[model samples]
Target: MVLNMQPMRTDSTIPRIVICGNLEFASAECESLFKGVAEVLVMNSLSSADLIEGMQPGGRYEGAVGILRQWNGFSHMQRAFIEALPSSVKYISSLGAGYDMIDIDACKEKGIIVAHTPGVGNDATAVTALYLIISALRRFSVAERQLRAGLFDASRVTQGRRDPTVRTLAILGLGGIGLRLAELVHAFPMRVVYHNRRPFVGAPEWCEYYGPGRLDEMLAMADVLSVHVPLRKDTVGLVDEAMIRKLKKGAVLINTARGKVVDEEAMIRALEDEHLSAVGLDVFPDEPTVNPRLLELPNATLLPHLGSISSDAQKLMEVRGLTNLRDLVLGLNVADLVPECR
Candidate 1:
């Protein structure tokens, strides 16, 4: 599946960039941008073995200076893959906002600069979070399930439905996605409070800010808790049993962030015990395979991680990712380089 866009040239003066996956939305744009600047090689295979082999001494990607890969092109880009990359490979651009699948520490060790598509999918993902919040709060998933099973009793389905009016929404991270969701829920007139490492400057007056040390206080006041932080070493299992216990009883929980950020088992226990009135999730601890226990819960609303799959978002992400690679090869500053690299 590896197709060299151009034949190997004897002259090594021109830099080479290897595209590790297909760009369904931005192929033409990629060619136009890279024209005459760098030799482009398209690696269509999704197999890690194929990529590793291509990076070998005498392989097709022996002299590749940059790599651009699709978000789901292969499995984790960990230490092994970093070690396999040719010394000429100095930069990598991945088409997604969250680069948790890429081992930043490993990339650092190899002196590789990594960039990701950020901000382009914020609106799409924020809208998805808003959808989950409303659906969970209103118990729409339960209603839909009952209707599909021919058990459509209005009284039964409306038992635990809650309205967003006057409810307090506590956001765990007030980054771009979190702020967008905050603005969205303002339509419902829900009171918004966010916990961040520091106060976000120029925040709307209606949106209250809580310092990092006041997370428990914010959780205690929230009727709805939405998580929007990235998955990092310190954030994994951040919303564990103890943290979830601090939330107001019967609080609705929504997570569009990485699943491992919250302890799934602990959340499930809270739901079973009625401590959590409802739960909504777009990402799971083990993606593509959700826990059966969550599926069985009447109050649990779930999605298959389709937060940023809109056509517009897809095209923007592809273009930004490719631009990052192009800029790196051209010796320009990379705007979307991962924070760890900067």
Candidate 2:
């Protein structure tokens, strides 16, 4: 396929932008940063066909339409969405990272420019996951809750002869964030081991590689277990009751990946029964709201999905999305343009 490698030109007429998914967030970025370059259409829900049908009236977007969406869990309608769009929709930019949910090959077949914001949230999310691992291992959530509920001597329950600095850590799915976390974990001289779908090339010397079979074995030996895998059919619910049961007694669990990849109910039970020491979750099966049982338990450190919230990351995301869309409209070359599924 021929790739558009030209640069962007703002001299063209005002383009139209259709904001799908969360409009409030996109509008905030566009109104504040994008200015008068494009016509913005903010809609909460527009069916795949409806979106394309709307653009067909003029046979194409007024100039070029930029389609923006968030990392909402996977949707099968993606193929339909991409196929329906007239070759006129020049660019599809995901607001956050992880474009796995979108069909890239389909976009590529149509020469639609596809780009995702990567490395933007790497540091923020890596730091968040590391914090979660530490909090879970030390049972910080339990103490915080106990003290807030007018209970004294919360330390007895939280700091009961536990030292995370001395325990081993096993990371599942060593992507950018996982590697960053590994670097941080090494500072404490902790034993760090990881299992990835494929062996990572040029991994840091501090990380010991383990094949898939070793994953179960590693879990049984680790005191802190962190998950960093992307959500896919093969990986969804990768860890269930059986896997949790394999972990060392009082082992801590941390998940920064998609919530659906884990069985939330099972995790809660493991924490309550003390089969697992504690859990720090930054994402949930249902986001913006989570299971009430998790909130009621002190053994869980639940973050409101702020793993990617940082000034630098947010600005980078805005700039990448804006630049990608601008380049596609101007028929310029965009870096990291993902194609759609065949």
Candidate 3:
């Protein structure tokens, strides 16, 4: 597959760009950015089936300049969309920080240019993870619910049992969010350790990198474990019964990354058995829908994928993503094009 790095020709046939998902928030900014250089096609999730027509022979996808995904719901359809696109589409960009929902391997195989905003939501997610850690450590969620339900008692909130010293933190897949979280948590002077597939380059002075063999060792020590890895074959269901059993009793688990990364059913069992203390999740195995049992647990705090929903991060993602797309469209090298992950 030949990759086009040169700027698309201007006054050349207008490059057709199709967008999948709702465009309520970003359509204006994106339209203003692309302006005269490209023709934009916007489709709601229901209309995506028509977009697929372009993917087939004699399809409308031929000669498309780009495809931009606003919402990450089309994982099952993404491959087909890419497959149907005419070979001329040079770039594909997602609207948010995480691109784990997209089948990047398929895009790469076709030599389609793929890019996503990273670090745009780093602080947002890091802050959310920190909140979960604190909520779990202090059992804030239970107390809040009790109060909201008018079952509140001063004694429970004041005398709730939690030993800060006994709580150890083990971060899985310590990327940008994990690293920032490590720094933020240190103000509490908490014990911090992390596990990554490869050794992190220039890890903070306070962090100790535990190799894979020592993952179990770290898990057993952790009273709180946070996950920050992307969803992939090796990562999906990375946390299972065996791994959950190793956690110290009353351990809290926080996942701000992909939901599929953790085995939801196994986590529920751990929580029910009291083997695990609490689990807080901002992402789920099946997004937009989560395990009903997880919601029933008093110890569990679940969020509707709010990690990167901050207004600031959203704006940054739009500006940065569009700038990259425009630069690439205008025949300039993108500085942060997703590098081939080793």
Each prediction's total of clashing residue pairs, residues at least 3 apart in sequence or on different chains, is 0, 13, 4
Model 1, 8-64: lDDT tens digits are 333568888888766778778887888777877788577778877887888876788
Best by lDDT: 1
lDDT of each: 0.87, 0.72, 0.75
Q: Rank all candidate structures by their lDDT, best first, as comma-separated numbers.
A: 1, 3, 2
* Model 3 TM-score relative to the real fold: 0.85
Model 1 residue 136 lDDT? 87
Order of candidates by TM-score, top first?
A: 1, 3, 2
Q: Each model's TM-score?
A: 0.94, 0.79, 0.85
Candidate 2 local lDDT, residue 34: 47
lDDT by residue (tens digit), candidate 3, 1-342:
111122223344767666665544454677678788776555433455676666556654546677766554355435765576567777877666667666677778777777778888899899999888888777888888888888867527665457555356899888899998887888877788999878788788678788978998899888789998887678789888888888888888999998888898899999999888788889888877888898888888878989987878777776777767776677677765666521
What's the lDDT for candidate 2? 0.72
> In terms of TM-score, which candidate is strongest?
1
Number of backbone clashes in candidate 1: 0
**What are the runs in model 3 whose C-alpha is more than 4 Å off?**
1-12, 22-32, 44-46, 53-62, 72-76, 154-166, 339-342
Which should have the higher TM-score, number 2 or number 3? 3
Better model by TM-score, 1 or 3?
1
